[model samples]
Target: MEMVRVVFLTVFMFFVLVTVHEWGHYYFAKRAGILVREFAIGFGPKLFSYKRGETQFTLRLLPFGGYARMAGEDPEMIEIGPGQTIAVRLGQDNKIKNIYLDSLDTRRNVIRGEAEFTDLENELKIRLNVDGEITTYDVNPQAMMIRGSQQTQIAPKDRQFGSKTVGQRAIAILAGPVMNFILAFVLFALHLQMAGIPVENPSYVKIGEVSEGMPAQEAGLKKGDIVVAVDGQTIGGDYKKMITLTSAAKGKEMNWTLKRGEETLSVTMIPRSMEGETGGKVGITPELPTRKAGVGETITKSSKAMVDTTDLIFVGFKQLINKFNMNDISGPVGTFQLTGQIAQQGIQYLTYWAAILSLYLGIFNLLPIPALDGSRLVFLGIEALRGKPVDPAREGMVHFVGFALLFLVMIAVTYNDILRLISG
Candidate 1:
């Protein structure tokens, strides 16, 4: 059962992250007038699928991760505006066409003075002639967005991506990660601000329940004994977080300060042990902090939750790195199998983890690692600085190597998980 919980946590985390990451890319790519070919959840063989617009959406066999297949993202298709439209020859050989558009509207083609195509297809190679200047557009059109599937048909002026301008493209790519970050922030803040939940008043620990034959019972602690202090340490604000300070002193002798009915007393006891990678016991049950919230209190608690969530993601990443160094990662077989067991905890535990995983998803994707949105942003930044694009071949090679390295890392983590499972 314990092993199951571990797997459950891993798989649950994986799905949440993958979905958010891909959604980031999908959202922006579409917005930018870049054609998206496919959006897939998971990897390996395709499990199920549906088609919407020009994209064939897929649910892959592996539940570990997902991808957004955007048009023009293919290094091989570097020649393509990333949108497809047939270019109408503007002049007899020598003169090209001129098109104009505002800087902000994200588009692949059909700008000011450009001859727009009548229709678009999933794959289109077009070159717009503007006076003497010839411009290229590699249109990756969605079927629905195109005028029709019929080869003879042409879309209206608005349907083709080749009609858009450069500024539109930038906005499209920028939208995905921006949305992901916003999503993380909103979900996290909402979870923090969940209203009217009773909180354990920092003034005292009102004993809610005592388990049969537990350490509290053996220590002569009874129901309604308000604990003023544990191990001579003051417990204040964020009971869930405070429990950790107490739990950390597990097995060491500790003193407690208590109050009941205008009476105060001191007692000494040791905390009990529970299941964890780190063994910490918790005795007291807590309600939410004060349900009544002053504006200041509400702001303080929300700030704490954001900070707490941030801390947890960093800690989890650190832990994963440590475990990887020690060869301690779990694979798919372990994850979903564990998910089945974690389901026993019902929705509350799942909800808690979902929120936690969402935060991680936002943070991890923002890391400036090659092949990720952050890394691409870095490349764009370089382009802006240089006033020209980076060497496409070099960027491609870097991403290739980065992808390979990450795959190896995943394998290592999976090996560790399996080994740990067997050893346990």
Candidate 2:
């Protein structure tokens, strides 16, 4: 039962992360006036689906990943040939009715330059270009449907993803990772508030070790003894404060209050006040204390946590590249195992893990690898600079290769995780 519970928790966390990431893309795409065809929470066969506006939101079988399908996001075919003119028609069949190219009438039924024909929300238009003279004819719905045909292809001017400006496309692509960062910040802030954020030091200092024959050891102080107060002054977990008070009170009888576990005891001893290379010698090392944070402090801590986590991710990436540490990488199996362990630690630790994982997802997705948001932004950047979009087919091929390599890397990482699990 415990194992089942762990599995459930792991799956639930994965679902939440993937759904939120996809929702980010959907939200931005909609805001950019692009038509979102589908917003799916997972891959594989659909378990359930519902249509909202023009988008079909679905929950699929696999919980590994999700996607937001925007219209015209996929590659569309375009044909260029030496001809007098070509008639491009938008209909249920996508078949050109006639070809007036080279002034010779020819009837060939072929789907030319297919576009996404999922829905017919726009008018049906047929393009006629004769000797560089271009004209568009808006065919009547009834006339186009005379032979059991309907408008299946969308024009470039329609509210499709490819029709959007480069800036808009970049925003839509970049929004997914941005949402993950925001989610991480919110989670971290909540965890800090509930768990009482850890401060530098709290209200007492612990004696780590005492040198024999020294004042602290001779006065009966020992390791693990927490100094609560010295000479009526509360140390309040400040080890430095206790040292300063001891230094000033050299040669005077000092009163010490120590907390040994649940019990407190008092001890008195006189300092030697000897001058040495190591300043005033208390002959005892202290351990730091943890201070609990309040509301404002928690917020500040959470913000710092976000910034620190981001910096750590970049540093880790640098190390991975420079040191080539494959062991440092974790795949789905390792992540699931870690998630289960965190779940057992309690809600606060689990929340903290969630925040870290969210930040990781956000940063990792921004890597300029193909099939990723960062890669899309890179392409858009090139398009912006070049004053036009790259060929769709070439771009699609590049993403396909990158995705294949990434998939293989994931397989290797999962294998390593399994081997490590079995060996350990």
Candidate 3:
């Protein structure tokens, strides 16, 4: 039964993250006046789908990732072959637009002779007809396009993304990440505020759980023990501080002050290392000892926690960068492993974690980094500065290269995930 619950939790968390992540892109794109073609959750074949307002939404077979499709993605004509004109589809047949290319060579390949179909493909993949479903068209096919087939393709036009003012294009590109950042902050704040957010209070440090047969058990410190102090240093009358002192003193015996049933007594407890990990182990736990509080207290505690947690997240990101290694980034498989651990933690814990993660994911996406919302925003910044939009060919080329690099990084992280699983 526990195993079943774990599986359920893992699946739930995966979906929650994917849903919130994609929704960020979908909502912002619409608000920016971009024509969305699809908003999808997951990858691979579609399992369920529906369409609304010229956008398709789909639930795919692989519950790993999702996307948002948009229109006006191309600005220049694409020459598919030598002396051969390709009829590219920018939209429906009646709404279709076409342009002729100067030559057949890729604008991206101009300096190096390579071609990119990303500007068109990414937009198509994001534009599934409101059913969250997306279709990836093969750009390598060297055949004439049939009528109505161009909706899955991009064409050259002033109405295309290349023609838009830099400010407009910048907003459209940056909006998704901005939405993500906002979602994360709001969700985190609200979640912590709910359930009378727990704060580190200097009250009685009541034990909630205990490790079996550990040094703490030998010392006779049982569950419900209200920790008072350690080594004669007052622990603000809290449980965590008591554990902290003991854990720090691992491999050595320490004096502990605990309140048991209205009786105050000092006992020596040793934190011993436990199997599976290194640390001082005191067989004890922390309890919330919940009480009904007024709205003010609840808000204060919750808001404080949210603010602290938010700061901590950014700190963690910086720390991760400083501690940069192949081990840091987590791809789909890495995320799956996290889900497994969350599974072990149980549903309620995972639910709380999920909400918190949702916000963090949103923020990370919004950072103007390459192949990320932040990076897209950088382009916007450039456009806003130059007063003219970056050349479409050049902009598309940058995104294509960035995306390729991003894919490589993902593969590396996924490889790390596989290694951890094998070693673990």
Candidate 4:
């Protein structure tokens, strides 16, 4: 049951994050007058779908990734061949309102014939042969194409993505990453509000709580006792250094000096090895100073946290590029494992992890790597500079190659994650 809960939480997290990212693109694209054909969560076979206005919303089988499909983004064309039979329903203006490529069992008063020529994007007309006579019919700009059990509205030239101005297109492409950053800010603010903000500096190591039956409790340690030294080495208020020393002790007996109410006392205990962990623990939590945050303080702290996290991420990226290491990179499998571990820690920690992940997603998508938002913006920049867009075929090919390479990298990283799990 615990494993199931972890899996469910992981999937839910992915769904919420990815959907928000894609919705940003979808919403802005619509605002810019571009046709968004589908807003889909996950990939692979469709599980459920529905059409709304001009967009089809779908839930797919896999819970890993998703996309918002804008019209004219793909190079391939959906066409009606010269000899294919099609059925059409006309509206009051005599323009074809619905074109049925298959499953015409429930239609009434519809024209059925073999398609001779079709231009759904620009011309919005179709030539058909009916009873040995050929005639051309105008198609509605918002006509629905029924194929199998799916319906997609036709995207005329003006409504297609490529027809939008460079500024509009860039905004639509950039909105996804922007939304991710916004989500991180909101999550960080909420977390800070719930769990008080930590102190910037500390001058002494104090005990917040002592676990029952743990070494610290057995050694007569109590809450509010300030740890003066360990093994005769003055801690100097460096809690991290103290923790390092204790963790390295690994079941070795050590002497601790504590100050309580102006009286110094000495105690002895051994650090115990913890299960599924790399260090030894005395079960003593640090008494770090923190205070309840007001609304204004929460906003200020959250903004600062976002800036700090972004700087750290960029530094990490720089280091990764300078000293490439497979172990330093993680894929979905590694993330799942980490999520499970953090989920066990409690909701506050999990929320912090999610906020960090959101920041990573936003920053990573802004990298000028092909098939990313940054790359699309780069193309738009070139178009603005040159007064003409780059060849669509060439740009599409570059993105395709980039996507293939990314997939290979994902496979390698996932393999490493599996190996680490098995070895551990």
Candidate 5:
């Protein structure tokens, strides 16, 4: 039952993360006037789908990841200006000739009437007979927008990803990871508000650790047991009050009221004095300080939590690269098992785990690896520097190779996780 709950929670969280990440790309692309073909959660065969506007949103079988497909992203068949009637011909001198367009209105992605075509031979005595106004401009084919897919063909270049400026393209690419970060922030902040921020030493004490054969251990007082009262007097959060009561009743029978796990228990034990300490010894350590936060404090702590978590993730990455310890890594299987373990602890802990995982995912996606947003940004960087885009075929191939390598690594990590589980 517990394992089932964990699996369910993990899958739900995965779906949310992937959807939000992809939606970031979808949102920014739309804002930039680029047509999104699909906003899909998961990969492989689709289980369900719906079309809205120019985008088809889909849910697939795999929960590993998701994607936002924008129109005219491919380098092949660059569309320029509206109008479907296009026929290209080169003269013997290899010059453009007889360009034709079929009444494609740039503003409206519609074709109302026929457009005129002219060749160099008839350039001197050109005849214009059209129902609609005709506007012509010299456009470079190389600079035209690329098509995402041929399914719902818009005016070749009307709302194309390739038509968008480099800055817009960069924002669309970066938005996925940015959304992940935002998710982390919101989750962390909410968790903080509910659970409270930690302090070094809290006045209110819970039994964190109990020494063997000590008074606490003998009384069946376990770790995470909260001491509520002693001898009918509420201890509250005062560690000093707890000590005074215990010290005054040393070697005498004392009734300790405990909130253990989810049950309230009454235990009787005689406190034993240590050699140097004045207070009675129960052989327990202080629980960390924690207090629920207000709205403002929640935001402040959440931001701090994000920064600290990011720093820790970078440190871990550094260790993974430098230490060369493959055993230290955990893939999907390990994460699933960990989720189960944390779920057994409680939902709040599971939520905290989710926040950490979200941050890790956001940071991981920002790494300049192929088939990732970071790599797309790198390609845009090249285009910005070179004043033109790279060959789409080459860029696609690189991403394909990178994806293959990453998939292999995932397989290896998953195998390791399985091995560890079997061995245990």
Candidate 6:
């Protein structure tokens, strides 16, 4: 039952995060007048689907990733080559409104013949040999291409992704990461509202909670007791200095001066060495004072926190690059385990965890890795400078190779995660 709950929560969190990210791309692509073929969640067989306007929205079986597929994003275009049989249905204006590639035997009042040549993107016309006479027919702008039971709209040159200006294309690609950042900010603010904002002053360190039978509790220290000094050295409310002193004590007796409600008291305690570690702990958690925030304060504090978190993530990434440790990184399995642990703590912790994950997702996507948003922006920048886009075939090959390499890395990371879980 515990495992089940964890799995459910992990999947739910991933679903929410992925949906928001893809929605960003879908929204901006529509705004830029690009024809989005599909907005799909997950990568496996479709479980549900709905059509709205020119886009088909689908939910698939897998829950790990999703995408907003835009027309002309791929290098290969759907073609009706010479000698291939096809059927066409004409509208009132005598233009082909639907082109059927299959299932022509059952349909009535349709012209079936061999396709001599076709241009669906620019010319919007098809040349066919009907009863030994070759003739060309114009196709409607919104004509449907039917294959079996599936129907997809033909993308004209104007509605394709590549036809848009550089600015519009950049926005469509950049919006996904931007939306993730917005979600992180909103989550951070909501968490702060539910759980009071932390006090930023670092002058004094007070005991928030005391563990039973710990060194601090045995020394008669209680919650709300402010540490004034340690070993005759004034703390001056420096939390890090006080922590350093106690951790260095290493089971040695130390004199501590405490202030409790306008009363000064002296106490002596010995720090306990942590198991499998060098530092000594007194078993007391420091109090981070918090209070309810108003609307203005919430906005200010949340923005500050978001910025601080982003800086920390960049620092961490630098350190990771310098050292390049595999264990330092987490994959899907590790994230699932961590999510379960955080969800068990409380709603406030879970909300904060989600915010942190969202921010990380946003920042990670901005790295100049191939097949990512950052690399797309790089390509756009090159196109703007050169006044033309790169060769689509070469670009597509690079992305495919990058995607394959990333898949291998993901497999390695996931395997490591499983090993750690099993050994434990």
Instruction: Give candidate 5 regions above 4 Å deviation.
Output: 75-155, 198-203, 206-290
How many clashes does each candidate structure show, in the order listed?
45, 6, 30, 0, 4, 1
Once superposed on the true structure, which residue ranges of model 1 sit more than 4 Å away at CA? 1-17, 75-174, 193-289, 292-300, 311-324, 327-349
Total clashes for model 6: 1
**Residue pairs with backbone overlap in model 5:** 71-148, 72-146, 72-147, 72-148
Q: What tens digits encode model 2's per-residue C-alpha lDDT throughout 1-424?
A: 8878777877888888887888899999989888676899877899998876657789998565789988677743232243323334344654443222221234244223322221123554555544545545554322211112211233234567878889889889889999898889989988876666335546667787787778888888888898889899888867778888777776778899999989999998776655553334667878664446677877788899999998998998898999886678888888888899998766778888999999999988999999888898889999999999998888889888998898889889888999989998
lDDT per model vs. reference: 0.57, 0.74, 0.61, 0.88, 0.74, 0.88
Candidate 6 lDDT over residue span 4-99, tens digit each: 776677778888888898999999999998999999998789999999989999999866578999999884345777899999999999999999
Model 5, 1-424: lDDT tens per residue?
7667777887888888888889899999999988787899988899999887667889998667889988776543333333444433233443333233432333233223332542221131112323566634233222222222233423236467877899999999899989989999999987887677676455556776688878988888888888899899997677667878888887899998988778999999898888878867777765656867888898888999999999999999899888887699998888888887887666777777888888888889988999988898999999999999999889999999999999889889999999999998
lDDT accuracy of residue 417 in candidate 2: 92
Better of 1 and 2 by TM-score: 2
Cα distance off (Å), candidate 2, residue 299: 3.3
Q: Give me the runs in candidate 6 sitting further than 4 Å from their true place.
A: 1-6, 75-77, 132-135, 198-289
Q: What is the lDDT of residue 247 in candidate 6?
A: 92
Instruction: Report how far off residue 35 is in candidate 1 (Å).
Output: 1.1
Per-residue lDDT value at 40 in model 1 = 95
Clashes, model 1: 45
How many clashing residue pairs, candidate 5?
A: 4
Model 5 CA lDDT for position 148:
25
Work out how many backbone clashes candidate 3 has.
30
* Cand. 4 Cα-lDDT: 0.88
Minimal lDDT window, size 10, model 3: 107-116
CA shift of 167, model 3, Å: 4.7
RMSD of each: 11.5, 11.8, 11.4, 5.1, 10.0, 5.4
Worst 10 residues of 5 by lDDT: 118-127
Provide the global lDDT of candidate 3 against the true structure.
0.61
Q: Each prediction's TM-score against the native? A: 0.57, 0.64, 0.63, 0.81, 0.69, 0.79
Best candidate (score: TM-score): 4
